[model samples]
Target chain A: AQSVTQLDSHVSVSEGTPVLLRCNYSSSYSPSLFWYVQHPNKGLQLLLKYTSAATLVKGINGFEAEFKKSETSFHLTKPSAHMSDAAEYFCVVSALNYGGATNKLIFGTGTLLAVQP
Target chain B: EPEVTQTPSHQVTQMGQEVILRCVPISNHLYFYWYRQILGQKVEFLVSFYNNEISEKSEIFDDQFSVERPDGSNFTLKIRSTKLEDSAMYFCASRGQFFQETQYFGPGTRLLVL
Candidate 1:
C-alpha cells in the first residue's frame, strides 16, 4: 500500500519569507510524486511532478520540490512567499497497479498555507 | 491550453434521488477519472475510465455508481441513490494519450444531499 502524509495541517508565513510544506510517503515501488495547489474556489493545479527524471523539479510561480529517496520525502518550497501563494497544497503519490495497466494517485490529507501581508 | 470542464457547479438533492454529474474532457484525451473530496477530507479516487469502459475502480465505487461515455466527448458519473454521506465536491479529471502524463482537474461540482 502507498500513502502520503502532509505534516502540517496549517502553516502561517509572512510575505517575502521562505515557505516550506513538508510531505512524506510510503510506497511499495519507485513512485511518481507530485505537488498540487488548490486556490480558493478554484480547481487543482499541478505545481510539479517527479517521474524518475530529476530529483529536483521546478514548478510554476516560483514553486519547487525535491524528491529525496533516502528520506521518502518530497517537500515543497519557495524562496519567497507572496500573498497570492496562500492556498491548500496536496502531496500525491502514484503507484502502478497490480496488472501494470495504469497508475493512480494517492493524495495526502492536505496542508493549508496562510500568507500574511 | 486545453482543460477539462464539468457541469452543474453545485447541486442539492434529496436522499434516494439519482444524480448525474457530467464532464467534458480534453478533446484528445483518452483517460477519464472521477474523484471526490468530502468537507475537510482528502481527495479520493472513485473510478477510472478508458476506451469507453471502466478500467479500474476504487472500493468506494460500488454497484450504486456507474460511468458512461455517452458521446465522443462527454463522460458522466451517475449515482443511483444519493445519501447524506454522498455529499462532497466531485472532481472530474482527464489525461492525454501518453505514458506517465499529468491529469488535469476540473473546477469541481459541489453536491449536497439532504
Candidate 2:
C-alpha cells in the first residue's frame, strides 16, 4: 500500500517570499514520486518526477523538489513566491502495474498555496 | 509539444442518463488513462488502457464503467448511468511507448449529474 501525505492543507505566503509544501510517502520499495499543480478550473500539470535519478529535481515554473530516502519525504520548494504560483499542489506516488509497464498514481489530499501580493 | 485533448469541456446530464467523455491522446502515445476528482477529493485513477484493451483498473472503476479506443484517435469513457455522486472533473492522460515516459494530461471535462 503506497500513499503520500501532504503536511499542510493550506499555505499562505507573501510575494517574493520563499515557499515550502511538505510531503511524505510510505512505500515498500523504491518509489517514483511526482508533484503536480492544478489551477482553478484547469487540468493537473506536471511539476517534476523522481525516478531513481538525482535526488534534486527541477521542474517548470521555477519549482523543485528533493527526494529524501531516509526521511521518506519529497517536499516542493520555490525560491520566491509569485501570485501566479497560487494553486493546489499534490504529491503523487507511482504504483507500478503488471510488468512495470504502466503506473497508476496515488495522490495526496493536496495543499492549497495562496500567494499574497 | 503534442498534447492530449478532450471534448465537451463541461456537461450537465439528468440522473440515470448515459454519458461519454471523449479524449484524443498524443498521436504517438501508447498508453491512455482516465482519472476523476470529486469536489474537494483527491484525484483517483479509474482505468488504464494499452494495445486497445484495458491493462489495469481501480476498484472505483465498476462494471458500469467502460473504456474504448474506438478509432485511431479517440479514446472514450462511457458511464452506463449517471448519479449525483458521479459529478466531478474527469481527466484524460497519455504516455509514450518507452519505459518511464511521463504522462501528459489534457484539460479535463467537468461533468455534472443533476
Candidate 3:
C-alpha cells in the first residue's frame, strides 16, 4: 500500500516570494518520488525525481525538492515565485511490481498554487 | 526529445457507446501506460503494457477496458461502454528501456460522457 498526501489543497503566494507545497508519503519499500506540474490546459511535466541517488534533487524551471527519509516527506520549493508558476502540482510515488519493475504511479490529490501579481 | 502523443484532444459521447482512445508512444520506448483523472480527483493508474501484453493493471481497470498495441507505434485503450463516471482526462505515458524510472506523458484526451 503506497500513498501520497499533499497537505494543502490550495496555496496563494505573492510574486517574488518563496513557495512551498508540502507532501508526505507512506510506502512499503524504498520509493521513487517525483514532482509533476500541470499548467492550465496543458499536460503534466516532470519537475524532479529522487531515486536514492541524491537527497536533494533539482528540476526544471527553477524548482527543487528534497527527499527526507526521516520525515517521509518530499516537499517542493522555489526560492522565488513568478506569475507563471501558478499551476497544479502532484506528488507521485512509483510502486514496483512482483517482477521487480516499476509498475504504476500513485499520485497525490494535488495542490493548486495561485501566484498573485 | 521524443514524447508520447494522444489523439482526439476532446471527445463527447453518449452513454453505452464504445470509445477508443489512441496513443503514439516515443519511438524507442518499451513500456506504455494509461492513467485518468476525474475532475478534482487524484490521477489513477488504469493499466501498463509491455512486450505486446498487459504487464499490470489496477482495480480501476475493469472488464470494460482493454488495451492494444496493434501496430509498431500505436497503442490504444478501448472502453466497451461509456458511463458518466468515465468522464475524465485520460493521459498516455511511455518510458524508455534504460531509464525506466521516468515516464513521459502526453497532452491527454479529455473525454466527456453525456
What range of 10 consecutive residues in model 1 chain A has the weakest lDDT sum? A95-104
Superposition error at A28 for model 1 (Å): 1.9
User: Which candidate comes out best when scored by lDDT?
Assistant: 2
User: Clashes in model 3: which pairs?
Assistant: none
Measured against the true chain A, the candidates' chain A TM-scores are: 0.96, 0.97, 0.97
Which clashing pairs does model 2 show? none
Q: Taking the true A–B contacts (Cα pairs closer than 8 Å), what share appears in each candidate? A: 0.66, 0.68, 0.68
Report the lDDT of model 3 for residue A109.
95
Q: Which stretches of candidate 1 lie over 4 Å from their true place?
A: none
Candidates in order: C-alpha RMSD to true structure: 0.9, 0.9, 1.0
> lDDT: which is higher, 1 or 2?
2
Q: TM-scores of the models, in the given order?
A: 0.98, 0.98, 0.98
True contacts kept of 2: 0.68
- Ranked by DockQ from best down, the candidates are 2, 1, 3
Interface RMSD of structure candidate 2 (Å): 1.2
True contacts kept of 1: 0.66
lDDT of each: 0.92, 0.94, 0.93
